[model samples]
Target: MIKESTASAFLFHVDGDGVCRTALVWHPRLEEWLPAGGHIEADEGAAEAAVREVREETGFDAELLPGPSLALPAGFPHTAPVAPWWVVEMDACADNHTREPHRHIDHVFVARVHERGADEGAVHEVRWFTEQEASEAEGLAEDSRLQLKALFAMISDGSLTVAA
Candidate 1:
């Protein structure tokens, strides 16, 4: 199956109630709630695509949390982009008569929203889900639920900071 590159952002923010929440959208095709993301365009890298998708889908400007950086020697010839928290390849479509089967190589990143904005370009209804709510949300993929749980655990343990 052909594989398409994609970038996904797990955008988190503190709500007025002082609870950390992540944005999710109801995907009609997949019939599940998922992170805001889409295919990486030909002109952009995964990190860039992640940020762009978040803004387009949620109308929020988000900054991706920096991943662990390598200690390169001074003045290295290469520039490193922000790394993703995780990467996985999953089936995008299967056993469909109209569409061919394909897999998506998804680069996942954790980000913090700078401020709230209008949900103008959102293609689907958006909702903010608390960690607990995400974990127990119906119609959520199992992998997504696991990711949410891990994100929440990291935040609680101070391992992953969502502050701007």
Candidate 2:
């Protein structure tokens, strides 16, 4: 099992089409390319934390798609996972603070955004970049890139469902 303090990720895809676009947050810590998510906090579920984190960090209010939280099983590296993950996303960032202060049992959720925004909450900025662009971004992990690739495939194949 992954440690509780590990940071989880949640990439929100907005208006995904030919390019398979997504919203990338410039995290101050890693100083690298990453999604709008972090550790899960106390007094909340992982799904709720993901939605709240995306909104607080990206100025986009996301809706966490319902289902079992996507937990990486023991010893299964990111590349070998065959099934798609729990996807969630939004383009409207709700007003909130972005200081993520918690340790957690990491659970990454993949989501597609419903709308595009030029500006929003505490998030310094927002942009629609293709999944390919994200995959090639500096400092991103191969596993993360593969995960995004899988997410795009699911989005393209109509296996992903978005709930308002």
Candidate 3:
């Protein structure tokens, strides 16, 4: 199958009411709600591409959390995984964006939004949804819901934490 590679970052933040929410972008071509992400540019790693995509799509600086470390023999070497949150292979229609039938190998990362403008409208068209809300939200991709569920589990199990 013809496949394209891309990277995405899930930006999570705690609202004033202390609710955990994630930022999603409306993908016009796909007509679905997705995280801030896009094609990985040349000379970019998956993690780096993810961060850049999030910034471009959401206008928020996102800091990605590291994934698991590599375990190699004393003399052997391996490049550890960069974006540890999630990685998925999914199918997509060739739309105006790509202009050809293709699939996407998505590299997903968990990140926290650092800076947002005072004027909410200034940010790109984005929506913030709580875990429960995301689960029931329409127009959301199945992968998105599954990832959100996993994220909630990670938080509940103390694997992820929001900084004050």
lDDT of 2 by residue, 16-57 (tens): 343457776765554555667754577666666677777777
Q: Better model by lDDT, 2 or 3? A: 3
- Residue-level error in angstroms, candidate 2, position 72: 20
Model 3 lDDT tens row, 42-121: 78888889888877788777888775555566876666556556667887777655877789888888888754444243
Clashing pairs in 1: none
Q: Which parts of model 3 have CA positions greater than 4 angstroms off?
A: 69-81, 115-124
Error of 3 at 137 (Å): 1.1
Model 3, position 45: C-alpha lDDT score: 85
Among all windows of 10 consecutive residues in model 2, the one with the lowest summed lDDT is 88-97
- For this target, which candidate reaches the highest lDDT against the unseen true structure? 1
What order do you get sorting by TM-score, best first?
1, 3, 2
lDDT of 1: 0.85
Two-way lDDT contest, 1 vs 2, winner:
1
Better of 1 and 2 by TM-score: 1
Task: Give the higher-TM-score candidate: 1 or 3.
Answer: 1
